[model samples]
Target: MTDVSKIFAPGGVLSQTIDGFQPRPAQQQMASAIAAMNDDAGVLVVEAETGTGKTFAYLAPALLAKTDDGERKKVIVSTGTKNLQEQLFHRDLPRIRDALAPDAIVALLKGRSNYLCIQRMDQFISQPIKHDPAVALQLQQQSRVVKYWANQTRSGDLGELTELAEDAIILPQITSTADNCLGRDCPAYADCYLVKARQEALEADVVVVNHHLFFADAVLKDTGFGELIPHADLVIFDEAHQVPDIASQYFSESISTRQLQDLAQDMRLLYGTELKDLRQLSTVADQLDKCGRDLRLQFARDPERGNWREQMRRAQVIEDSERLADTLDRAQAIAKAALGRNKVLDQCYERLVLLKARWQQLTNTQRSGYSFWYETTPRQLSVHQTPLSVAEKFTSYMLAQQMQWVFTSATLAVNGSFKHFTDRLGLGSAQTLVLPSPFDFAKQAMLFLPRYLPAASDPTMAASFAAIAKQLIAHNHGGTFLLFTSYRMLNQVAAILQEQESSDRLILVQGRTSKRELLDQFVDAGDAILLGTSSFWEGVDVRGDALRLVMIDKLPFAAPDDPLLQARIEDCRLRGQNPFQDVQIPQAVISLKQGAGRLIRDALDTGVLVVCDNRLVQKEYGQTFLASLPAMSRTRDIAQVTEFLSKD
Candidate 1:
């Protein structure tokens, strides 16, 4: 076995090769612990706090592992987000591989949507323009840009095109979904980027993927095309705190009005180009499109997610669903009749059948052990049937795989117990490890709970939050993050601050640009205040003076109206447990920890975490939140907070 300690020790391989290297005891311990488990087939759950150098700790073992016969071991490292996935594959992995395992072959695999679909791009380029002249011209220009780049690109990963905006409309037109992809029948199948990426992953000794792709491929394995992720002897999950929710999403059965509409559009396109003689195809396609729209209209105008079981009880919902099913049956019949005429049509027929079955499954509320929920946008709606608990299914898969599993994250345990996470994932028997952050939190950070703040539920809370934010930003000069629980509150506070902006310090809002762009602007403009919601709370690292204050407007609690939370609460009650204590508090504690973790990211970093919620000090359950946080100096007086910030 390779000596991991030698690589992580003072003046070791990493230190000698990498600049600004400091030896951390916690990081070395974590690496050694993980290296010791590479020989066995058991689960290891680790809560390595911030600054633990967890990325290198896990990567070193996986890259250096060898089988009993002395062959290199295969490993899969899954991250919580695409950004992190790319970082690990493109930046971190190469550094570690060069230092220790220079021969290790590594690959990065993302979901199919991330890669450009050549067949779809060809179809999109050839399609006639039916939009307004100006709109058509814009699309034509965009298509030409994509065409030019497509010819020169090797990887065909859309992320390579940095000039294009993430929300570009041309992207959806060029990309293919599972329902629309022609698979082997596609003319571009031989050169398919997604296929090539998956093939590389299967051949590589190490593969990096995100949580969504891992679960998505797991679910797709039943369909026989889920070869995207190869079975590995060692599996490591970074940011594993996000696994339960992401796993639940994949395990659930869902059908969306957008998908139905897309099917109808595909049928119409086929009728226009391939099968001009199929008049019934166009008729049923139009009917299906109208039925989907009608069903969406039956829901409220404002976008929301609610209990699908309750919606099914309404007459209008039931009526529209029946009409949709009838239209789908008609479309399927037409598709079946023309199956032999076109491969795309045959695939469409199969999709119709699967979609109809999923629709039935989602509408059936009588099934126990599942939560039926529905969410709506301005023009689309999707229904889901999610299992209340993924523990049994997840556990069975882990046991059957017989691979050494490692789950590591900074925010997995709550109040020093892993029960909440372990129970949710059925990993109670797994060995657990918690390594405190190497940073001196007491000396580098302060927890400020402002006094006389409006309650989180009060209508004037946003105004009060804005007032406190103004004070903090004034003292800090603008290196501040005002995190909110909702967009409404964020916007309200943003408006109030905008009206009072008189300083040279810039104020950046979330929606004005992409997250990456916003962060860049905030960091570049050293004195800037950024107001954001959920996405800014975690997976954000701005060490040093760029970010010195993080003020959370409220405790990071799941909304009570959330259909999944409600379902879980009711299920807990039925099982004779305190849902508030068992489910809600733990979940909130994890979220709070994630939010607070934004502060003091490095040993030299210093910041003040100002949680505006008074409940942190006034309520009995507040102690749980406090205990889960880092051991920082506590203060309730605004004078202390301002004095601390002024010291910098």
Candidate 2:
């Protein structure tokens, strides 16, 4: 340990110790690695297991590296979710600041829209919202949540409103768009949260931000990283697995049909009249809104939206989409041309053009690497595609930056090789290490793939899942995560499982009780079955046997009929890359690995990882999936599963 680490030792007055929060070996290793970066290498990729205090591990090195002035020179920490962003900003940053330098200025910087837009908010407050449902309910509320929050908030970030439901609040009414911002000249500029946060970031020794903001700053060169970075000597990235995805998005851009609709809303705000301009912008907005609704109606609507049955109409879609695409393209140009004369109008128009272009390119491409999809809500519509690789892009810009770059995640490596991600991030010859989770996998978890089951898409598969549920239900008796890829599948299986069991049980589904509350209920109950999907795959932690049986319905493969998947696979084939091995199989393997990870969260945690898909035994690629997981003994026999669960 260095002098700085010793200063934070348990007995030292300056010790940054959390009571009962014992640090891990990986934390120490990571700290050593970060320290090594000052003299040795610039990049380090670490796979910190769930129980590893990875945050502090990286933070230790980060704190040690802070210039003599403070901890906030050019440190940019990024993560996958907004929740984590708040966690670091509110919790970790303070602890680090107190332990290191009290004067260390650390600021949390999010996107522009997070801050309250006084211009937009004024429009929303004064006028009667036309089509927005959320605004309707808020108009009745005497509390005026947006106004109250706007009054108190330093950031104007709508995210701070934990009490507000996303459906109950209109984001645009409070959030500012980049183009619509009145800059420093506006009346609200003196107390602007965005400006304050920016000023803090510019002055701080440590700046905390998300991966999205970091990439946007680098690519757009818009949010002013230039002011903070050049004077700073080092940069640190946390939750670095998400960097590539965010990096690519920043490199490219998206404009959606929803922009036109927003433009109309903006016109309502700006014109403060009957929208009498030759622009017909409001009418155009109404047309775009209707066009989206009509075009979406062309698809058989799935209430859950993820359903292939409701969404997929193979031959019929191409014809309908072609005409829709051309019409959108023409409208997009009109919106853009109109924007040149009007600032707010221009933002709305540019937004539409970008969406139109994105939608057309993604679905139209037959190339390898990219995936496209049609995504929409009643008020908004967008088509987006994930880039095949951002490796070249990331490396060309940031690779040569002579500073510490740390990428740590629970899921980054596949089959013990970091190459899948390493190649993608273009971290050529960077120091790479996969720190095996200290959790005792053999004792903590058991792998189970029930004997019966058809393919995921088979009509009869739901019935088979119900029968298997009976046996698995008997084992945990109720404290189990019945994870599904489809909401309909979960609803169907939940209906079936209810018929067979007599045991007292609590059932919770995603989005019903709020994820945190549902988790609270799930954790408190003596017997519970929490049914969830994608969001639950990685984060949920029920340590020390509260969670025993992790029953995956089937191997999670990307939906074949998905517009995005279809485009990416075709694109890959054109490039001569094996879509299965290069993309699909590897991607599925990562997701499965994340789901399986829920089983063993702690050293004492023990459970059965029952992957109900028999394909693990039946197919050649099954081995690939199995090989992708952490080292744990496997068995084809149900006797082992029962024996493992039978333990008190």
Q: What's model 1's lDDT at 532?
A: 92
lDDT of 1 by residue, 71-108 (tens): 98999999999899998898999988998888889999
Candidate 1 wrongly placed segments (more than 4 Å): 38-40, 222-224
Best by TM-score: 1
**In model 1, which residue pairs have backbone atoms overlapping below 3 Å?**
none
Estimate the TM-score of every prediction. Answer: 0.97, 0.84
- Please count the clashing residue pairs in each candidate, in the order shown: 0, 15
lDDT of 2 by residue, 109-161 (tens): 77776776776677566775565666566654623766777678766677877
State in Å the error of residue 511, model 2.
3.5
What's model 2's TM-score?
0.84
Candidate 1 residue 486 C-alpha distance from true site, Å: 1.4
